[model samples]
Target chain A: MSAVATYVRLAWAWTRALAQYPASLAMLTAAQAVATVGELAALVFLFGHAGRLGGFGLHEALLVYGLAGLAFTLADLLMGSVERLGEHIRTGAFDVMLVRPVPALLQVAVEEFSPRRLGKVVPCAAALGWALAALPAEWTPLRAAAVPVLVASGTVICCSVWVIGACLQFVALDAREAANAVTYGGQAMAQYPLAVYGRDVARAATYVVPLAFVSWQPALYLLERPDPLGMPEWLRFAPPAVAALLALVAAAVWRAGLRRYRSTGS
Target chain B: MEAVIEAEGLGKDYTVAEGPLPRRRRRRVSAVRDVSFRVAPGEVVGYLGPNGAGKSTTLKMLIGILAPSAGRVRVAGLEPVRARTRLARRIGVVFGQRTTLWWDLPLRDSLALTRHLYRVPRADHARRLAELTEVLELGPFLATPVRQLSLGQRMRGDLAAALLHAPEVLVLDEPTIGLDVVSKTAIREFLLRLNAERGTTILLTTHDLGDVQRLCRRVMVIDGGRLAFDGGLAGLHAVAPSPRTLVVDLAAPAAPIAVAGARTVRVEGPRQWLELNGNPARVIAQVAADHEVADITLREPDIEEVVHRIYAGR
Candidate 1:
């Protein structure tokens, strides 16, 4: 079977299994939506006092926050289980995946698939739609096109970071926390204008992690704002390329980690 | 004969940490070293070793779960590590200590998932599932979640899941690790029938002697990261010191029983334990002619003893 088909089949099976417990699933999904809304509430309350964050008003800041939240949540929905590689490795479940006729990466990606994660999407989509309609920035065909491209490429970038972080489990075995620092922490860092964290942090997010491209650089173009770090204007269109390069790097790291894998004792 | 499973000097080296932090140094350790063996088609070979031996390492290399740090391995004419995904279609693996089935799903659902993962044809999957459910007796708990099933039931489910792909070769690790006699017997019988009917080549790594005695003709023993012995079960028996015993009950307490073919090793109140060197019947007859022999029971060497001898460098 093709890789996509196999992944869908595996994911679908898990989804069906999760559906068996309707009440618990509903409760968990409600909790997820409430959690996302709570985060947005904190952001909105901050805007109520400060009026502007890093020289961007409420809708402008919401645009960046929405794009980042949507991308991070999408990646989290798809590849969150990869973070549990350490647990699987310790328990030898990962070895079972290795012997299958499918790629281990694919197996790990779809593990514990739950539709409850879809709850996070609703608020982010609402915020992005509201911000897009309310923002005072001039809308152009090019800027409109950049929105989907930005979100898609950002999702890819976040997924790549997740895989790259998961590779640490093969060697360190307890690096999940360190990995979470990069992936979840990156999401937290991306939810505002990069300049809010100052110049050095902005440079690191831009060059080292490529997280700035997820929402910051592209949202700046949509907001018609100048680069806070004084970087080139063309960097707004750089997410897709950065995402592809990071994906290749992530794949290489994953292969190297798999090669270094020494399975648990029987 | 072309071997269905082949390994040439297959080895795995791990870098292990030693000592305390800051002063800790990494050391290169060989989990498996220079192990080579070939198994022909339709053969049930028992790969035996004590704990920490290289049995699992060898099996991992063969199944492509781990790449051998040195040497090579092939299963079903494909290099296991290089063509692991391709090779996986032709081999089924069961690690008795862990279940590959989804924990929260019912056994039937897990089996259905396996069918899709392996891409088994719908009709073939149905027929095979029916056969396995009947033979392994998985029907009663087919709808039970894997976590709720007993160990024996879970093992049967795991076996069904592994074989759902109709793999040409099956690799099982400790298939009967912890189970009651009845469950063990059921599994052994199922495996024997699988090999006989389908002619599936099996490389079983087990600490269970009964599993080996019942299902395998050829046995391989690995110790301290090397293949120590590999041959028939009878040959393994021969590697052990051949000291058969005859426990004979005498009518009265005696010093010892005098026999031509056996020597008295121990004496109780009314019984004598004689180590036989030749025909036990002749010894019993010789003792009966002179003394009142009440009863006699002969004991063969245990396979566990034979395996320990091999592991201890016999």
Candidate 2:
């Protein structure tokens, strides 16, 4: 029928792929929840001792952590397939994706809908929500003012990392962990106050890639605080523009890699 | 009949690396050398070659999977590499080694997914599935997980999956390589009906000669990454000169009875192998009825021998 209809069908199939394995999906979701809670124990201890680090209190830190965690895990669920894309190309598995009537990029993006990673995501989401409710603040206006921008920017950053990782595999099959290091490390460091990692790491993260925007910067505005660093207060919403730029650059890299794909020996 | 696929001087070159941490070196190998041909609509063509014969490379070129190193290919009026978006909708491919299926999902889920991806109408999907499952005997395994299927079962499912889209052109690579006799027969019969009844153009690359004999009227042979033979099956045989062989395993090894039109070759305990005069099927039938024969068989020379004969003549 229509091209959009075909994409919808393929996306449905990908979701069903996860549904087919209920136990795996359930287990992963629980694992993610537990991990997020476990990470919160650390957040609680660090924030309990010191009232604020780089001007972020307990609730604000949890806000950034939870949203970033959710976005990262959501992207991981699909992007895992993109990482294995090299092996797919090497084994000629990519050929199957190519023969379909849909766009190759769309087909590959939804190819893997992983269910297990939620073992960490659900807990992070809960912690973020819990932190939001427990804090003595106006909840309705805060979320309205910030959550959509938070989700969009976080998604763009995660999607950009996913594409970059996949593209790197196209060039060098063995460099997967290196890509993971940047993605996982970036998310972890950005979830907390940059003032903890000292000035250089925080500044590099702030202006260069702007990983801090997802959690650190925007949470400042929601929490109604000034920048812990000597920088201006408006840098809090900086992640979205950075996210958009990274997404565009990531897609460009992917197109270049597609041209360079030699495929398998056939 | 109009040509559904056309190719001119298509080629693929590959460079392989040698040595891990030792003296580094490299080698350049060509998987496909300038090959060209055309297939008429509603025609079934067989592509045959020994291992590493570039048959697969050429098929990939037609399907837009591999970009050709040189030359051009047009399948259904679209350039394979330059116009893949437009080309993908109208082609169905089955690479027997791969299922193109979701491993964890049920057979039906994967089928439904394909139906959606192809944008098949709900009514059309229901009818196609009913017709395909009937011919391929896929009902029993509809809800079963794909990871649990046997090779033959999977192969049949793959064939059925490929045909679901109702594409104008079908490309099958070694479609019946590991199937049991019953399944092989079913697949062959279904393919024949599809080509004749549905009028779909088919390009088949298979190791099984029986698959070629049963399904295709025209056969193309490639050797050493190059085109070796192209034309009808009759022309193919004429190119092979291993003196048509007739082998008979007798009930009693009745003394190598001198047949008028055939030359007797080797005689074993209960077997007699003979070189016949041109037509061996007629002689074998007559000899089988005349002699006290327990079992009889007629064999075309193996592909290797045929290739050898063609080379010798050259």
Candidate 3:
């Protein structure tokens, strides 16, 4: 079987095991739904008081917010289990993964693929749909085509960040929280218009982290607006390029970390 | 025959941080150093070592779980680290202390996933699983979640999971570390059968002397992260120089008997125990010539005693 097929099979096995605890799974799924809904409520409440956030109106900002959230949700669904690498390393479970014929990365990513995370997508996709319906921009074929590309590139970019962050667990097994600060924290930052942050902070997001390409750059193009920080116009279409490069870097980092692994004493 | 498993100058050095937060010191500790050995195909070799003697580290290097700090290792003609995935298809590993089976999934489900991971054909997988289940007595608990199985049952499941792909070589790290006597015996028997029927090359590290006595014809004793002794089991017994004890019942009570090839270590009412380092027959004959003997018995040192002596001396 191919790696992806094996991943799905492993993940499905876990999901079935999880389904054994129906009540707990239901409660967790409902909890995730409520949490995301609460976030959406807070965004709406904030926009109720102000006319616009960072020059984008409530609907415009919502488009950016929705796109970022959808991408993050998908990335989390696909690669969230990589966060458990620290626990696996601590308990020597990572060593078990290494001995398998399958790639250890695939094993780690699908270790506990929770279906509970699927709840977050409902609210995120709903928000994106609402924004698309409410926005006043003329729907050109090029502009309409950019939406799915934006989300795809954004999901890939977020997955790269997730994996690269997970690689740090190889050196500092206790640094899981520190890695989360960059990934989850970056997601929180990406869910907003870049104009709301200070000039240098937005610049860092553009060049250093490239999180701006996740939603802000493409959303600017989708909304037919000007760049607040005056980045190159070509960067709006550059998320795919950026995502590809980051994926390569993430793969390399993962390989290096695997080599550095110090398996625990039996 | 070509060696199925080979290691040349294999070593691992760990740089560990020690001391308090204010003044930490980094010390280089050698876990394994300049260790090398080989196992021919279909050979069952016992890898005996004390705790923390680099047994697991050596096994990990051979299985490609750890990249050796210095030296080289090959199993089935592939460098372990570079061709780990390829080598994995040829080698099966079981760590007695840990289970590779999914904790919450049923044993059968884990085995099914293993089938996919190793890309075994369904017909082959079913046949192998059936044979393993019968041999390991895993049928009753096949549907039970691994987390709920007893330690012995879980271990049986682990063994089956490892063997489902029918690897050419099996590397076991303490395969009988924790188990009831019956369970241990059963696992040992299964392993012996696996070797005999399939000609699978077996390398195992164990603290249990019974496992060594029953399964391994050749033994390698590692100490201080080095290959201290490697040869047949009889050679390992010779490393300790422990003597055989001879017990003789005399026709009547007498003072410590004078003998040429033996020394009287203990004396009782009508018997004496002599420590004999040479031919027991000659010593018994000499004692018989000096005095009438009722009966005699000789005891050789057990493998455990010889192994303990080796560890303590090292």
Candidate 4:
């Protein structure tokens, strides 16, 4: 049949498989809810007493937090273990991906689905509402449309980092824990204001990996604030723009890595 | 003869590098080199090699999973890796070490999925599943989660899963590597039938030599990333027309008639194996006449011995 048709069929199979383990799925979902809500509660506790840290109020921090949580959860839930590309690539399972008759990224992207991530996705939406209610906002149609678009862009950027991390596994099979700095660490740090860090580091993150686009800058535009970092308004939409660039760059790296994927024995 | 699969001058090179804390490229390692082979339609050819041999690499190239550094490959008149969706519909692949079937899903669901993924007709799916379930003996575990099934049961299910698409070509890498004897035999028999009746061309890379002897008529042996030998299984082991093995069920341990024409290959708890090296008719007649034969059985010189002898250069 068609490629889209095949994806749908396999995705159905994936969902059905997730349905088989109801208790595990429930536990995972609950754990995600607990994690997301727990993190938000910690933010409230810390910032409630402190008043403001990094120029972000408790409610404003939730904006960055909720968006990042939603983006990461959506990508993680669909891609499953692909978020752990460094590990999979270090092992030889990545080779199985290369030999299949589809685009390697497409195959990797569709590899696993985690329903437990719905725990975080739903909570993120709830937190977004809470944050919006707590903080006054000028909600134009453009700003409203930018929310999910930004989330999608952030997901793409995060996935790009994952793909790049996977490509690096060819050189350092174990990923030297540095790959995590790009993937999981980047995800964790992306939810906060990049301005919290030094100019050099934030610039590196913004220009090199471009993770800052996912939240910090876009939050600037949505919050209608002065350019604290002195970047253009368009720069806040860097999540999608950088995601697009990173995606192309990631495809190139994947191709280069495929040329370099020396398959190992079982 | 039309080639369903072809590869020429296939080679893969990997860089081995060590650098700073984050990004560095400095090392070089060549995994496969100068490998070439062709598989014709309806032919069951075994790709045999020891550990570290480039069998998986070759299979990857054929399947379009890996892009060769320098070479060309075509499967069933198409570039599989480049046209994966088309190839997915035309071929079935199974990795013995890992199951593609979902762990939580039942065998039926997995099979139903294969049917849908391959876009098999509804009636065709039912008919094929029923036949495979019977042939692979998957009836008992059809509704059970694939994870819950024993290794043998899971293997049988995987075999059926790979065949659901009725792929014109089946690339089985280590298909029976760790199966029980019964499971192995059942898979072998099924593969033999598949090739005979449906003319499904099979290129199997297996560590299990018995699979080669029983299921594959021709064999390709690769060593150190290169094609070492590509020919018939029998020619790999030179023998003087010793058609059958004399498995003498001796009445007693010392129930020896003579060991002149054949070699006593093994002596187990209660039985003895004689590799009938000479004329089968003469050996059988002489043994029957001389010994009080309680019972006797015949066996074939397996591809295991042949491949072992070849590897050892005996």
Candidate 5:
């Protein structure tokens, strides 16, 4: 069988095992969905009081928030096991991957498959749909088509950040906190309008972390808004290109980390 | 016979950071040094060592989990480091400290996953699973979750999981560490049968002397990151010669019995302890002929004593 097939089989088996505990799985999924709903409520109240923050109306801001949440949650569903790489390294459980014929990254990605994460997807997608229906912007055929592509590119960018965090676990096994700062922190910052942040924070999001490409830049294009920072208009279409570059860099870092790996003590 | 596994001066050094944060220093600790050995097809070799004696480190290198800091190793004619994925198809590894089977999944499911991972043919997988289930007595708990099984049952499950792919060489570290006598015997018997019937090459690191005595014809003893002895079990006695103790209860308390072939190490009111370097039978005969003996018992040296003697001699 091919590597992809094997990973799929492995993931399917885990899903079946998780299904054995239906009640707990349902509770976990509900908990995640409820938390996201609460966050959406907070956004609604904030927009209700202020009317417009950083020149983005309630529906436009909701679009950005919904897109950010969808991208991050999807990435988390696929690559969230990367967060446990530090624990695997510390406990020597990662050696199991080394002894297998399959790629270690694939094994790690499939090692922990959370069916509960499907819960967050429902709320985020609903919010995105509501925003798209209520927004006043012209829904041209090209613009309508760009939404899925942007969401996909955004997911790829978020997954790259997760892969990079997993790679860093090899060098610093206890750096989970630092890795979370980039992954979760990036997601938190990407949900807001880039114009709301200071110049330095916005620059870091664009240049240093590139999380702006995940939602903000694409939102600008889809919303037909101008760059508040006076940047080039072409930057709005850069998500796909930026995501590809980040994925390449993340793969290189992963390979370097594997080369330097030393299995934990027996 | 062709050699199935080979190592030439294989060693591993770990650089561990020491001291407090800002002033932390790196120190290199040699876990294994200049350890070289070979195992032929159909051979059962025992790897023996004390704690921190590098046995586990050497096994890790051979399995391709840990790359050696120096020298080289080859399993089934491939360098483990460069061809780890290829090598994995030809070898199976079991660490007694952990289970390779999924914790929440059933044993049968875990075995099925292994079959898929190795891409075993459907018919062959069925045959192998049946045979292993019978030999390892896995039928009783095949559907039970791994976490719910007993230690012995879990070990059996792990063994079956490892062999489902029919790996040419099986590398086991402490395969019988915590098993009860019944479980250990069952495992030992299964291993012996597997080697004899299938001609599988076996290399196991264990502290269990019973496992060594019953399964391995040849043994390798390592200490302080190096090979201390590599020969038959009898030859181990020569390297670390430990006296056999003979306890005799005399008719009455007498002067320290002057036996030529034995040394009187201790004396109680009506009992005497004699240490014999040569044949215990001859010493017993000599003592029996000279004095009236009530009861006698002999004690052979344990594995720990033999290992201790070897380390002390070094």
Candidate 6:
């Protein structure tokens, strides 16, 4: 079988096994959905008191939040198991992966197939739809076409960040917190307007980490809003390029890390 | 015969940091040093060592999991590290402490997934699965989750999983580590058949002397990151010459007995202990002729003593 088929089959097998415990799966999915809705509720309350925070109206903020949340959830569902690479390494389970004919990165990425993460996507997608309907911005053909591409780019960028964090396990061994900071923390930060953060923080998000390209900048383009930071206009079109570049660099780092891997003492 | 596995001066060094912060010093510890060996196709080689003897490290290198810090290794004519994926296709590995199968999934599901991962054809997979299920006796627990199976059952499952790909070489690290007598027998029989029938090149690192005695004709003893002895099992007695002990009971309290080929190491009351470097039967006859022998018992050296002597020589 091909690599893609193998991955899909493995993922399907995990999902089927998870489905065995219907109650726990349902409860976990519900908890994930409820937790994300609670975050959206906090945004609603903030918008109720203020017309707009950081020049983004309630609808525009929801657009960014929904897009970011969807991207993060999809990435986490697919690649969140990378966070456990350290544990696998320390426990010598990583040796099992190395002995397999498949690519280790692909194996690790699909190792933990959590179906509950899909629950978060439902709420995020609903919110994005609601925001799109409510926002008064012009719905041009080009802008309409860019929505799915932007979401895909965001997922790619988040997944790349996950890959990089997983690669760090070869060196750090205890990289959970660092990985969470880039993934979960980045997701939380990208939900709001980038303009609200300090100039240095904004630049870091734009250039260093590129979290802004995940949703904020893409949302600005989709919303047809002006760049509040007076940045380059091309920044709006940089998500796909940035995501591809990040993936390439992350893959290289992962390869280097694999080479440096001294398997745990059995 | 073509060498299925070859290593020349294979070694691994780990640089570990010591002490605190910026002033920490780096120390290089050699886990494996100047080790070299080759196994022809269908050869079952027993790699014997105590804990921390670098057996696992050498196996990891041969399986392409660890890159050697010095020298080189080739498995099936391919450099393990450079052609790891291709090498992986030709090799199957099992670590006794861990299972490659998914813990939560049933044995059948894990096997099915493995079939896809290795791209085993449907017909071949079905045939292989049936054969493994019957040979490993996985029928009862085929639907049972791996986590629920007993250690012995789980081990059988793992062994089957490792062989599902029909790998040319099967590298097992302590494959029979925590198994009962019955389980150990079952595994050994299966491995013997695997090697005999399939001509699989088997290199196993095991602490169980029974496993080595039953499965391997050629044994390699490693200690202190070096190969101490590598030869047939019978040659081990010569390398580590453990003296056999003879207890002879005389009718009365006897003076320290003297024998031509044996020495009396201890005497208590009417019994005397004689340590013999040569055959015990000849020495027993010599002692019987000299002294009034009421009873005589001879004890041969056990594997532990032989291994202990081997290590002690170092």
Measured by DockQ, the strongest candidate is: 1
Q: TM-score of candidate 5's chain B against its reference? A: 0.84
> Retained native contacts per candidate, as fractions?
0.87, 0.66, 0.89, 0.47, 0.64, 0.77
DockQ of 4: 0.44
Model 1 CA lDDT for position B208: 75
Residues B1-314, model 6: lDDT tens digits: 77899999999999999999989999999999999999999999999887888999999989888899999899999998888888887888888999999999999898888887787889998999999999999999999999999999999999998999899999999999889989999999999999999999899988777788899999998888999899998898678877878989999998999888888999999999989977777898888888888999987655557777997786
Q: After aligning candidate 2 to the native by TM-score, how far in Å is the CA of A179 from where it should be? A: 2.0
lDDT of 6 by residue, A159-228 (tens): 9998898788899899888878888888899988888786777789999899999888998888887888
Better of 2 and 4 by TM-score: 2
lDDT of candidates 1 onward, in order = 0.89, 0.78, 0.89, 0.76, 0.88, 0.89
The alpha-carbon deviation from the true structure for residue A105 of candidate 1, after best TM-score superposition, in angstroms, is 0.9
Per-candidate DockQ vs. reference:
0.69, 0.52, 0.66, 0.44, 0.64, 0.69
Give one digit per residue, the lDDT tens place, for model 4 in B1-314.
Answer: 98999888988776666788579767766668988888889999999877777888788778776678788888988876567567866888888887867677898888887676566899998998888888778998899999899888888888888888788999998988778888888889989999999999999998776787788788887777877778887765553132457888766665434666777777774477777768777877787687666788877655444445566763
Tens-digit lDDT track of model 1 for B53-141: 88898889888888899998889999988899888888999999999999989999999988878889999999999999999999999
Candidate 1 error regions (>4 Å)? B241-304, B311-313
* Predicted model 5 interface RMSD: 1.1
* iRMS values for every prediction: 0.9, 1.9, 0.8, 3.2, 1.1, 0.9
TM-score per candidate, in order?
0.91, 0.86, 0.89, 0.84, 0.90, 0.90
Q: After superposing candidate 5, which stretches have Cα over 4 Å from the reference?
A: B242-304
Tens digits of lDDT, candidate 2, B233-295: 888877775566788887785678577678889899889888877566678777877887887
RMSD of 4: 4.2
Query: What DockQ does candidate 3 score?
Result: 0.66
The sequence of per-residue lDDT tens digits that candidate 3 reaches over residues B112-141 is: 989988999999999999999898989999
Q: What is the TM-score of each candidate's chain B when compared with the real chain B? A: 0.83, 0.87, 0.80, 0.79, 0.84, 0.82
Model 3 residue A17 lDDT? 94
Task: Give the distance in Å from residue B113's predicted Cα in candidate 6 to where it truly belongs.
Answer: 0.9
